[model samples]
Target: MIDTAASLSRFKRKTPRRVIWKRQGLAFLFLAPGLILFLLMIWYPTVQTVLFSFQNVGLTGSKGWVGLNNFDRMFGDPQFIIAWRNSIVFVLLSLIMGLAVPIVLALMINEMRRFASVFQLIVYLPALIPSAVGLLIWRLIYQPEQTGILNSMLKLVGLPPQLWLSDPNLAKPLIIVIMTWLSAGGSTLIYLSALREIPVEFLEAAELDGFSPFQRVWYVVLPLISSRIQIMLVLQIIIVAQVFTEPFILTQGGPASATMTPVLEIYNAAFVNSDFGLASAWSVSMLVVLSIFSVIYVWLRREDTGMN
Candidate 1:
């Protein structure tokens, strides 16, 4: 009897251990592919870029160690300053235009009882289009001549045709506009989803309390969706800070580097100038800035949530 009881107790303990081991093994098995891909695609490249930043890497291969020389050259370059300034401007503009517009649009759409689905599809259509294709289309619209869509519209209104992408003063704003148009749809959808998550009873109660449309949105809607707004704000900042394709396609950081962004400068350093080391250094600098931004965003989010 004593031997049987001891055997039963051992089996009970061993069974749980065996089950836990099996479950953990399955979890690791499921995670293995993603882990391998992350290491290969993200981790390896990041490590390589940091390593190459300290060394002179040429088109052929590794050249020689250059220590901080690449970073010094990058900081000293006038175009680098221009790129960084432009990146900051772009991020701020995106926050103002890109973030606010979508929220407003989403709020308006959420109020619509009829044709909501149609409105959603229409708004989201641009987001579904390939970014490269949309940029090319916008390029045609932004052409400086009278044949351009925007120029033609301006001419129809008896306004003088202006160089949209070629003018140094206009290029960056045009880029921001195009970016907002392209990106607003998806953000609007996200905002709409968050709006749906709000309790209908709260909205109704506010309405009964004589809350105006604007007041309801400002007080009730904004607070409930503030988390999503913060998330989107951070995402927009990261994206706009690293903007490359619009400037690359529309202006090529041209018209006296007006549209030049840090990422654009990095691309020019690597491919155009064949200075991989300098490019890697620029990349590392950008990474550091983004990391700092992310940390600050997290801290702010924690504080906001704690206060709530």
Candidate 2:
């Protein structure tokens, strides 16, 4: 009897260990495919990019290892400076338009007691359009000639037609406008969702305390949605810093490299100039900038989780 009792206790303890091991095995089994895909798709390319940055790769293959020669060439290039400056300007413009406009739209949409879905659909419609198609449409609209859609509108308003994408000064800002028009809807939806999550009681309490609509929004609503604002700000900065497609399709870094951006520079180096090594170095530099923002994103996420 004593032996049986001791054996039963041992069995009970062993069963839980076996169950835990089984669960762990199953968890790993479920995670294996995703982990393998991540390694192949993300990690492998990242490693290759870093390695290629140090080598003089061409159409044939790598000429040989060139140490930091690719990086030296990239930094010394005048276009590189122009691209970096343009990227910074794009980021600032995106912050002004992309960040504030969405919040305002979201707030206005949130107050609608009717036709809210219609409003949402209208706002988000542009986002549903293919990026290439949208850029093409905007390209035509930004044509320098008087027959261009925007220029035609200016004519109707008795205003002078202006060169948009063709003008070095206007090209970058026009791109930003197109970007905001294309992107603001999704951001507006996100902000609206965040705004909805704010407890009704908080707003009611603020109202009872004699808060005006503006005061309530400024004091109560903004604070609650501030985290989302931070997240969107960082994301916009990262994205605008890598502005490529719009400039590629619209300006092609032309009109004195006014709308040139880092990613565009990278693309030009690799495909246009057939200098893969220099392209990879430029990519690595961009990666460093993006990684800093990525770290901030992760830290902000953790802080938000802790606060919750």
Candidate 3:
């Protein structure tokens, strides 16, 4: 019989270096298109934005050096300050809704034996709708006049119809509620998947040990899925920090700019005000803040994991 292992070793030893070079080069050739497109579409614009933030960009396509003037103006503007503060509030409201609700819903769905798939489908149905469509749906439901769904319900109940999203105090929270309804389903599905991944043997062992249901989840299930939870939390922060479309499409940062957010301000600066440099400054500030916060969060998680 031929020695297959020795024959393979001999073949490997006999292979020419040019063949190896050709194979490696082919791999790089496949990667080249993606790399080139990324540079052109994403990376090049980012670099341009950062560089542009330092200059005075004019309506006539003129540009001049303006050392920190953009940043100074951004800080001094009251609307800019309101937008930044609102952005922070937006982040907090997202965490408040995003953290516990999805996890609880996932746990409930996981425990359900009958109708589990039906329940999952219901929860995730909103996520299937495009975000813009979802927002528009909510806008119609929350429309100020008595024609709105909620207002009509109040009319039936003999309760006076009141402003929903138009109310300043209610606007931000209501928008967050809309986002939570749309997004929580996706997060719940992710958590449900994580729960499904738990070993059957581990649960069996926990049961045999006389551990109660909550005990098993608290000690075994939660620790197993903790990493996913942390990741979701971090993602929520990053996403909410740049929230634009919710306020943009629904409220237009309205009710005295109560719902104003940094990204919306950036939009107004660039398009509405035609101040490209100021818009670039806002973009750079968001990048810097988010980058710093992400680094700190990862470091803390690493320390908790004893990988620091």
lDDT of 2 by residue, 98-124 (tens): 779989999999999797778988899
Scored by CA lDDT, what does every candidate get? Answer: 0.89, 0.91, 0.90
Q: Pick the candidate with the highest TM-score.
A: 2
Worst 10 residues of 1 by lDDT: 299-308
Q: Model 1 reaches what TM-score against the true structure?
A: 0.90
User: For model 1, what is the C-alpha lDDT against the true structure?
Assistant: 0.89
Q: TM-score of the candidate numbered 2?
A: 0.91
Clashes of 3: 0
Report the error of model 1 at residue 199, Å: 1.2
Candidate 3, after superposition: displacement of residue 258 in Å? 0.8
> For each candidate, what TM-score against the reference?
0.90, 0.91, 0.86
How many pairs in model 1 have backbone atoms within 3 A of each other, for residues 3 or more apart or on separate chains, i.e. clashes? 0
Each model's RMSD to truth, in Å? Answer: 3.1, 2.5, 5.5
Report the error of model 1 at residue 241, Å: 0.4
